[model samples]
Target: MKLIKYCLILALFSPLAARAQQPAAPAAQAPIVLRPGDMQVQARSAANRPDRAPVYPGGEQALGLFFLEHIKYPEAARVKQLSGMVVVTATVNVDGSVSNPQVTQSLSPECDAEARRVVSLLTGWQPAMRRSRPLAVLIQLPVPFGTAGHMTVDQARRQPQR
Candidate 1:
């Protein structure tokens, strides 16, 4: 009986002794912080090299037409003499909806607001594709605001932008 007790005690303590003999895991390191530009660069690369880029329901020409019809060179932007393009970075969701629209380049507050509004209004975009499945992709769009941009959507639709 004495031998059995000692053997059992040794068996139980053997594992503990082994564990104590091993070194402890190294202390966990702090997580790396991602800069704002890092995400933009990564997103741009992914969007540009996608298996298939997101498309408007009708295609590239349709996208051009869509912007033409929906974008209304804001009156405030016009009055403020705001020209040039407002570049908006957006995520075309897997369900063909836009989310996370952000002004990457500022033309003016009015122009930026107008650009966001137009992006918000857009729906049913064909989502990006990879391996025959839909994906979310970051895309940058330029909305022009000026007399130089004036044109009827119908006319523009007839002659799609290249």
Candidate 2:
């Protein structure tokens, strides 16, 4: 018993054991150094690339205005005082048409349906281009319901739920 006790004491107090108990120091990371032209290889001339993202007919502001003008706040959501963004996903075909619009994130059943309706009505979308060739791409749009920015207080009050 004494021998076992002595072995245990020795093992617990050993220098190697004490070192193992301590947290290890983190290794130093070398700073990344880039030469003046290190990034030039990855960049291509804009004229040659011609890669572009899809654009709405009028632009971002116009798109937002379109939504604000068209979105009908659901009566169910208005009664509940619900305010949130419903993400609607759709594909922009090569011919500038929207297809397969679906609600990716749901705020409410009524709000989701309303969002889909608005998104379905969208038109005149310039399709994305890669190497100067038009490409079909999926796009997600956030439809706001009963939100302060989207549905103005006056608008909500004036157009009470029917």
Q: How high is each candidate's TM-score?
A: 0.58, 0.62
Residue-level lDDT of model 1, residues 1-162, one tens digit each, is: 999999999999999999999999989998878887764334435434567789888876776677778887778877777768789999998999998899999988878988899987779988888768898889898777675455555575586342
What is candidate 2's TM-score against the reference?
0.62
Instruction: Give the local distance difference test score of model 2.
Output: 0.83
lDDT of 1 at 97: 93
Model 2, 31-69: lDDT tens digits are 877788784433655543326778999898898888899
Q: Candidate 2: deviation at residue 95, Å?
A: 0.9
Q: How many backbone overlaps does candidate 2 show?
A: 0
Q: How accurate locally, in lDDT, is each candidate?
A: 0.81, 0.83
Local lDDT at 5 for model 2: 100
The list of candidate 1 runs beyond 4 A from truth reads: 1-49, 148-162
Q: lDDT of model 2 at residue 23?
A: 90
How many residue pairs clash per model?
A: 0, 0
